[model samples]
Target: MRKPIAPRTIRGRLLCPRVDTRTVDHLADGLVEIDEQGVIAAVGPAPAGCAVPETVPGTVWLPGFVDTHVHYPQLRVAGRSSGELLTWLERTVFAEESRFADKNYATDVAADLCRRFIASGTTTASIYGSSHPIATAVLFAALDRTGLRAQVGMTLMDRDAPPDLCLEADAALVACEALIARWHGHDDDRLRFCVTPRFALSCTPRLLEGAGRLADRHDLPIQTHLSENPGEIAAVAARFPEAAHYLDVYARHGLCTERSLFGHCIHLSEPEWGALHAAGAAVAHCPDSNFFLGSGVMPLRDTLTRGVRVGLGSDVGAGRTFSMRHIAASAYDASLLRGARVGPEELLWLATAGGANALGLGDRIGHLAPGYDADLVAVQVQVSDPADTAELLDALLFSHATEPVRNVLVRGRRAV
Candidate 1:
């Protein structure tokens, strides 16, 4: 007679983030005990006398990546733009997003987006839905079934958008309210509704303020764009004459707070940096998108030195890939261009733990250890047996050679 083994477990070579940039805990052969509630009960060297799943050598188990800023409706348009931000939006982006108004089209995209997330090893994400409420609802429904955690928002825009993509302030707010009521805290808060105001230029003052109020009333996180380009900056300045600067437009309207996540802050003045730090808000640094659009590089070193939180984003359609590894590679290049050396350990941290921290889910995610949610990704590095941490990271994060994700788990549930 065979006795059934107890405790659920997974094992492999592990690189666990302590949520500290200075070091990463690498266990050459490690074990993670997952509990009934799907939290990591214990993680370290595998215990003797306890039979466990066969450990896979050369498979590195790391935290599932948290994508801080991505647009769900813009998936199809990812690699099409060769021009700068505004022109590309008018010529290519708007039309693609407008098609989401069709329910069937939105449904298909929603399903495909979920599969793409799993394939890319993304478990948690902060996503921007299109301006259409029905399309956003379809997306939430799709995500709900797939066990992916996300905070989604219908893009709130009342001006300067194509007619098909624009929703009046009042109407947009109402739709947001409806969405929040249905899915704000679904599945024990695994999914949430965020307040997304597409950026200062596209949203009117009233819409932005209303969005801020809605987020406040529900205590939701906010996501928006910042100083990503020069012309965009000038346009923002022209649109809001009274604003001290571009950041102030959101600040004045109550969008700047500890729970805010601003994307592509590549260009900023001294005061802007100070204010951003003081507000306790975070940035979703999309190096891939910055390079794609020829936007200026974000001063990663200066920003981190100022104690501002940052997370990596695969700002798709604009960023070029769904893989965070690609984003990490681009981030390294960005730092080198700025004369700052950012190694693979820190870039790995940015892609996982840093992103979790930026999105206010640090305690639960960002690391693989006891008391943390069991969201993990197993990547088969190019080098089967790496000599050291640097070698491991080089193959894992920086190299152009693609590494396959062997397995993926979200809260101990296998998504792939």
Candidate 2:
């Protein structure tokens, strides 16, 4: 077990997503008292009977970013591309993922992935492991030691994949069940198990249905890809001819629930958007990946107008950077490309609170309010004027692509 953080109070300049509004709350000079259990005990001006606080200058305290979608096995594949989605996956992605079948390789990569996440200021993430169950187990063990919060799953694919990477349906389900028994809700629910079907094109109906049953039996969240590319959408339509659209394929199998997180809704029609809204499912809008692979921009306004929950994803390998700031900047550009305007507050919310809310972790990790986990990132930023929070944030998102994340704390224990 990881060592516990000692309870203490911190005083700094705070900028965080407000619980009830779309904007951020700027406590220019504020105090946050953390209890022994690493939960926030107070927020605002210093409480009565407090000691002289330790202060850090030129630093801004914000909620550690929550990355809703990332592929653990693809960390090394980040800048490599094959022009588009399906072809890219076949040529580069699949070949790279096949390396995870080696347990030693998986362990080394898992440790490196956790280190990069911490360095990039991502506190919580929903991760996709390769189809190897032992490799997936290695990932969980690595995360357990690193102290990052995550929901990890073994990618389930029974067809349309390399033979060594695909598992039979029965064996896949058994592996998932065993993984859930061992890792789900482990470490005070900081480490979780997500049932992942690679996507409709790669998974047969039997495999998708069995994956849904496992998610339902464990009441776990489900993560998978959706209409990411035009070619991919057409292939799903050809594969599931009985379904109305791509989203309907998983909906028919009971996978479209509030806990379902569908990555890349970039090619959806009106009816498909309606289905997602009706199902109360969330979307991980991977603008960076879309831009990198020449996939069309996601219609951010239409999806939000339809009342579907949405968050940003780095989608690394396909996504160019691990920084949530880069994701937010890309999302801002994608929104403008679609003729919609997105403010920095909204983009920051997507990176932090919106992601937590989408993943059903809203009440615990998103904000710095009382009773919330003390997961925070301290970034070194110089603010000459206190009222320039908006301008400061704008520069941070668009200009400071490689800003140093000075410290990262999960449950008040420093991780980086």
Candidate 3:
């Protein structure tokens, strides 16, 4: 097998903030030295003996942003918000997702989504594919061709979704196991498996239990939805009468572990927060989707104070944008609406390192530090109105397509 090589010279005005949970730092006029194989060798001042490449100015370099949660099959249906979460799913999402059964269609949209993500400065994402294994495989193939680092999983729903989207419980588990065996840890671990169950309402106890078993056996990360909206919660409550709450359904099935990533945790209860913190599971705070669907704002401050791990998600389709910049901006607005404010540093951390941590990839991706993958982005700063550099960073927290992401590198190679 051929090995990947790093760039001879990666010249730019680097803007990496230390995204560690312990402390954060922002560096300007920085330069990153990449080794032969696409990984960061050094970051900061160019060494004395090194041949310096011509500098590229007027662009801010950042570690490629990580999106903790997104649905690949729903990429084409962005901004289709007519009603709340459940209604939107039935009226638009499920119907559009069902089209992934066509392999050609799946391949085309997968490539489109990958391009959109790169254009927005995101280098990695955890994505959910359609239930069809062939469709999921096509999505993976598209990502492989596109050069984005991703954990892509086939969506498993035994019930409640559209008839074409649903799968039999045992059959779905078998397919998931086969996929893991084939794709987990592929491409030097750039591509991975995420055992995905659509959600509690779409899955029966048998399916969730089987999925948990498969995940344990393969040691794969798990992804699913939680208490996203009142209607969805009510539907879950109605379906699982024996469970205490929405989280309880996953908890009882052993799906609430540190490796599990629950998306759209907007309307969670106090006990659910406690359980999530105790379980060491991560939450993907998808503010744009919540706002678009008319769902409640996520309790970001409360979750943080409770010591729960949180990251950002561009819950595309419902989220209306592929950029984590949009998600970060929406997050700040969501926090303000909930009577708490997130500073620029914190918001940047959420989009980069916080997201890496949420996906259990903190040490591997999401930073410009040595030993991390050389996944970086160059963003052109163009403030619409009068704003200083400090305000520019904050503007990224809530603006729409204001700045252009000029370059994207994944694994030391140019991606966009």
- Arranged by TM-score with the best first, the candidates are 2, 1, 3
TM-score of each: 0.96, 0.97, 0.94
Give model 1 RMSD, 1 decimal: 3.2
Q: Where does candidate 2 stray beyond 4 Å?
A: 1-4, 46-54
Better of 1 and 3 by lDDT: 1
What is the per-residue lDDT of model 3 for residues 81-103, given as tens digits with 9 covering 90 to 100?
Answer: 67888888889988898898898
Question: Relative to the unseen true structure, what is the C-alpha lDDT of residue 295 in candidate 1, on a scale of 0 to 100?
Answer: 87
Q: What is the Å distance of residue 330 in model 2 from its true position?
A: 0.3
Winner of 2 and 3 under TM-score: 2
Error of 2 at 358 (Å): 0.8
Q: How much lDDT does each candidate structure score?
A: 0.88, 0.88, 0.83
Model 2, residue 133: distance off in Å is 0.5
- Cα deviation at 129, candidate 3, in Å, is 0.9
Cα lDDT of model 2 by residue, 1-416, tens digit: 43566887888888878877657888877898888778899889655665746466667788899888999889889988677999899988988899999999999999998998998899999999889999999999999888899999999999998998999999999999999999999988989999999899889899999988988988999999999999999899988999999999999998999999999999888798888998899999899999999999998877777767787889988998888989999999999999998878888887888889889998998898998999998877755674688877876688654668888988888774
Instruction: After superposing candidate 1 on the true structure, give the runs of residues whose Cα lies further than 4 Å from its correct spot.
Output: 1-7, 48-50, 55-57
Worst 10 residues of 1 by lDDT: 1-10
Pairs that collide in candidate 1 are: 78-317
